[model samples]
Target: MDDGKMVRALVRAALGRALRCDPDRLPIGLKEEGGVLTLQGEVPDIAAKRRALKEAAAVAEVRRVADQLHVKPAVRMGDGAIRDHLRDALIAECAFQECAVRVRDRGTLESVRTPIGTVRGTIDVSVDDGVVTLDGSVPSLVHKRLAGALAWWIPGSRDVANALEIAPPEEDNDDQITEAIRAAHERDPLVDAVAIGVRTQSSVATLYGTATSEEQKAAAERDAWCTLGVDDVVSQIQVVPPTAPTRETRTA
Candidate 1:
């Protein structure tokens, strides 16, 4: 019809194709004017809302994306079903094989010993009003984070409260903690370990160097914070564009 209408139509078509899965369940509306897209509608969960905005932004000529998508549970799931689904999902993931998932009532508490260390604490999962709370202790911070992420992946999970604590490990000096942080950065595929430098002092780890993007910088800091003996993490990493010239290569 008109230029604005045509742009809206193109963005809508692209979003429809991107959200092919459960299109009926996820209903989204779009408005585009002057290359800006505004998304409005209800999505099944946070992931679907993010996907809608991301797809709209990917459309050609789209300058900016405004997200007005609401999160509504497509299907009301009982606590038991949510628990079973979360447990199965965690078990299916290779990273969480060692951790066990237990579903409990909102007020109930349970304790279990972790297989990694002789750490005895609670690893309980409870659901209330579609909010999942992961409360307990784990031998390592990785397991604690994994539990929270797995809970979020479950359907009908509106929010997650990860209160899992890391059990005390044998005391390690600052040098050992620094090496562990370095090794962690190297192991993560998203982080450029060569560009990151890790240092630890009095159980506090500091990350210094350049990262390709903000996400990479955050990941490097997260890896450092997740290290066993790290009490805190200070991120001094700078985000540098790949095309930016280095100081050594720049000529006056």
Candidate 2:
């Protein structure tokens, strides 16, 4: 039968995985009565204890999470001080320069910038010893990764929880095709050698190069034709005289 003991055991098992702690090493007690679950544990830090409570709350039949968990001495930190440090660390990370996320009061997130505009969101920062938990949402995946990377660079941060979601990069009508064309041009040795200028519109590649012979002009056009997605090539190559001009003075 699924009873309180079973519920507590399940909660401990789940939280062990969530916080990446050994299940046997995690000291937790679970009690359930009247469909409510009470979680008791001595977690290394407040973050781990909170994670335990969250895991219990997600249990199939858990009505509520009574977080009676205690913080172990080894990993405890002053909540206010930790928050302030996190704020300073986040702001000081040079990689986050010009980023939309605002850090304040340690790890409390104030605002996030996005293409649409600023977003109002609450960020919870919990520190256990030196590990940091960044729980918040930004606007896109790029922002999420950026914030996580920044968090890791903080002086005392040993780990980070990146629970942010940001919008994907915008889609432009011709961006992919244009990028592919550029990549192809970059890979070709002839494109680099001849001091050629290539511009593409509607899959048609226009190549302008300084060619001194018909052979050089043909070779340049052929290079443009071979590039994938280049449906047509308009050669605007100027083939100047290969030999230098000689000045002549006539004597009467």
Candidate 3:
């Protein structure tokens, strides 16, 4: 086989091994050309689909991954059934136990209500077809992401629209916001906080620095965007390969 064909074959084999443990994703189809991998076939939920893409992208020499996988629940369920399943999952999670999970069908609100006197915050869940929408407020960005992940994990969920707001403890100044962004970046293993400069002005966070890859750049932006009180994020970050020489080094 030619070099191109060999590379593609190697990528396929690597991806297959990566997903071998997950029976639900074992049937996913993979095709690679010019280092770009395309995923086909169906998975049970959005989480499975994301896992497949992540596994494919981790293969050596993979430049990009295109997701064409569909979400097909093992058993067909109505909107009501899907909502109940999501509610049970949310209430069982320690992080979400204090939050209410409401379900809506299409644009119409469903009758499933969390009791009248519940004091905890509200998290509204809407289901249309298999797609889910999460709205309301959470104490932190972590909770918002957790809620969305839970919703996406449901068997029948095709996608998730997470609109959950993060309730800031108090008003934060630009400096505090910048510090928060920096802390978030430092906490994330994928980001190199030392290389990234964070600044906030008028509730907008701006990031400046060079990242080793597009994924790292995006992770930095996400960290800034998720910081409390950050109204917007302006990413001035550049993607530079690890082997590339820096201008400062060249001048020195």
Q: Tens digit of lDDT per residue, candidate 2, span 1-252? A: 567777767777897897887877767777788988876756554345555666778789688877566555433345555556656655554433444444444545555332234333334456655555666554433334445444443444434555554344434223333343344444334444336666778756677767767765665664454333344567897876557545553332
**Whole-model lDDT per candidate:** 0.67, 0.55, 0.69
- Angstrom error of the Cα, residue 20, model 1: value is 44
lDDT of 1 at 115: 41
Q: Give per-model TM-scores.
A: 0.38, 0.34, 0.43
Better of 2 and 3 by TM-score: 3
Over the full model, what C-alpha lDDT does candidate 2 score relative to the true structure? 0.55
Tens digits of per-residue lDDT, candidate 1, 1-252, equal 987777677777776676675443448877776667788877665545655666677777778987666556546788767776776665565555455545574555543224474324446777776666777666655566556655654657665667777676533478767765675676567899999998888877888999999989977875664454455667899999799777877974
Residue 136 lDDT in candidate 2? 56
lDDT of 3 by residue, 1-252 (tens): 976666556656665665565433366776777667788877654435655666666667778987677677746777778788987777767666566666666567653446456445678887777666788887766566556656644667665667887776434468777876776676567899999998889877889999999999977876664454565677899998788668998999
Q: Identify the candidate with maximal lDDT.
A: 3
Q: In candidate 1, what residue range of length 10 has the lowest lDDT sum?
A: 110-119
Q: Could you give the C-alpha RMSD of every candidate to the true structure, in order shown?
A: 14.3, 20.0, 14.7
* Candidate 1 residue spans exceeding 4 A from truth: 1-95, 105-123, 127-132, 135-190, 222-232, 244-252
